[model samples]
Target: MLTAVMQCVFRILPAVWVLLACLGGASAQDYEAGFKAFQAGNYAQARGIWRPLADAGDAQAQYGLGVMYERGAGAIAADLGRAAHWYARAVGQGHPSAQNNLGLMFAQGRGVQRAPVRATKLWQSAAEAGHLMAQYNLGLAYYRGEGLERDNKTALRWFRRAARSGLPDGQYAMGQMYRLGVVVAQDNAKALAWYRRAAAQGHGKAESLAQALADDGWEAAKLDVPATGDAKVEASPVVPKQQAVGRASPDGSVRSAERSSPAGSGTTGSGQGVRADAARIWLGSLRTRAKARQHWRDMLRRFPEALRGASPSYSEVDLGDNGTFYRVLAVGYPHPEAAGRACQTLRAREPSAFCKVMAGGN
Candidate 1:
């Protein structure tokens, strides 16, 4: 995710200095100093100049403070509390970038309580104010019914707003929705159009979807993606996986990987392990009708015939022993052996994709 603000100005000079001073004088001088420090990764010096201005209620400065807190720049530890504080301060003053950051933090519970409902509100506020990232996130929240009732029509509406704003996530999502007829009538041409737009922005998911559409005999134009400049965007932290107790790796690549971790207590997964965890998280998050449908659409971009446009039978199965809380998804297939095969393939690729099978009808 991109941070709220990145530019810097002179802390000693008054705000009006830029208006009176020559372009190559005070304004340029201050900017160059800060820019050099930022380029050299001297976030401390950059912050020294920016913090006072931010504290003095400069919207851009407030935004810069939010980014610094979020990224833990200038030798600061990552503190969600500080990040939220600065973001709220900037958003309150009508900074679009700050509004977008606040919405993202609310959605992910970075420095605030996890409230998809509140996140929906913030995203709506920002989207209405014409923030592009907010528009994309708002569309996603609506599509997923996150903190709000599911309304495909409204989701499509927000998606249109985001697409018009040239947000890649919105374009990718809209393409998927159009291809599957989730909110509107199914239209391959429209789906292809949106996919192309996102692919032009170098979105990986959109590129894959576009390729899938083209494989079905639809021709789409390739886009020339521009090289991104040296703007420093705040990076999200990676979520680590917890180890399951009492599990033994009998041998092979799995055992060697397990040996790397003392009892596999943390999320430091080897290359193979990371991919497996990603697959598990993806599968685990999809349980409700809406999520399942979205999962199906995503899968279609890769395995178009996997679901055959039919809903898969899914059930919750207990995985915990001694009253511990745990559940895994059991997806039914026409052939019992097919489900078994699917489980094996996923497990081979990602060891955590195991699920206890049940009767298919349920």
Candidate 2:
């Protein structure tokens, strides 16, 4: 099923690549230096710089140190205990990457007690904080009911969130969901669009599926809904932002979600007469209704003065297959540009913040 396919895709990707890609933090210079040293086979030097910074409570340094310990790199012995230790320290500081890795360790029982529930909790925390990989992992967990209730609707919501954030795994999962008619209604056009998007990013199965669709005369441009527009703000390409360390099994195989069931039922419609010219800053998307409400409450608590008279709002989008998604929007903007500027201001504190202009119909 879908879960099996996801598991296979995870197995194909190298765990080391996920770790290396997720290495990021505010200490850009130090992290870059260490990364260069490690890349050049100067493990000892890399560790030397990272250890002292890690001791000083630098999250990035702690994460680097944890990686070193986990892999036995730079003269350090492979010590899962020490790896977990540093990871925990970083996680305490709300480090997204650390949360993801620590979740993996907990899931695999590496130096820590095996607790799928705890692992899922950690993934949820990181995913809500805008960690792409954690979002995908959390979706998988919900799909498999590994540590949480079996909720394909919730799983699909999480997957859509990750896909919207431009994660290839999420895009591939969405493609699978649409292709197989798993929670949402089967829409070959949407499936092909998602597959093509993922394939463009080098996802192997997505590439194969997209090619197969093409061979059958399917065209992505024929999809009913257009893909979301690219962000106007140009983020720095070199800096990794909120990266995710994927889940791994005891045998070192990475674990991912799959899909199996047939398409379910749901309504599909467009926004009513809401002004298409208006826009809002999208804080995040949540899989559950309760969580989305809680997120709005938290946003109010965090920015009381700015949101004193304003209230957070959300739109539920139905994606056939009994799947529904809640998009948490901070509305009250005159135009898309205004919302975009407001999003930039929000990003000063919430790095994952972005703006989404509302289209006319729902």
Candidate 3:
């Protein structure tokens, strides 16, 4: 079941590589047809279409075949050895998702020998590229000192990074930390918020905990800025009170919603939130959504009139291995013209600030 679920996170290739591939950076041979077939459950056709492409050195195809073999989805029976081979090929070509999945294989001693160090190294590579699962896994490794030195600070950083992107595992971890009052300050409000987010994403443990929290009278929370104690504890990632987690895609890819959100969808994070149309002025992508809040505050103080009618929210951009960034969007504009005018005014005032008019939705 774990292997099957990991298939949902199969393609974490870097955005630059995807861009390069689009701009003739790699072989132009089409492989999406195979993906379509797989999505349609035509495993035989997917295998047939992928074999030649995989053999011809198409990294994406190689990764697909690796996944197909791992799942025994095609005409061929389950072949862990072959799956590892294909994953290795894709990894050699800088496929971040393949690196992450293969790292799991190493960690579990499935196709390859158990090598926690190797697994951690692969996870580090993928995590650095913005693979949310990899980031979570690497954070766990850091928390445990698994094949690496234990660094709670580093672990917290990675966990927050993954959680900010709305990874269920990472969000759950955040909830646990807050609930336990371990690394972070104990804040039930923040814990409840994180739990609700993870629970909405179909995390079973989170669902159970969320129900418990609600029964205990906790509600969907605002940013619960906890007091800093001896240890400098920051608040959990801000998930707006209105954000609704997207349902999983029909294609069964866990990150599909995330993939589409950045292309002007106005949604935020991996699978978190409804498309917020009130958020019209896109302030450009920053490394974290936390930064979006800070940026918004900065803009409000610097140019109050320029942001005449705007709310606080963001559109998340998850770039597989390229990393995740949040586009700070100011909500409450009535139309494109109004939003455009606001952005234009802001631009006129601060020439370097990135401000784009993103129209609203229902």
Highest TM-score scorer: 2
Q: Rank by lDDT, descending?
A: 2, 3, 1
TM-score of each: 0.52, 0.59, 0.55
* Residue 72 miss distance in model 2 (angstroms): 2.6
> Candidate 3, residues 167-244: lDDT per residue as tens digits?
656777777767666577878777777776554344567768777877887665554421111011111211111111
Model 1 weakest 10-residue run by lDDT = 9-18
**Pairs that collide, model 1:** none
Off by over 4 Å in 3: 1-29, 218-221, 224-362
Residue 98 in candidate 3, Cα distance off native in Å = 0.2
Minimum summed lDDT over a 10-residue window in model 2 is located at 259-268
TM-score between model 1 and native: 0.52
Model 2 has how many clashing residue pairs? 12
lDDT of 1 by residue, 296-318 (tens): 45543533222232234333322
Better of 1 and 2 by lDDT: 2
lDDT per model, in order? 0.46, 0.60, 0.58
Clashes of 3: 4
Displacement of the residue 355 alpha carbon in candidate 2, Å: 26
Cα RMSD, model 2? 15.8
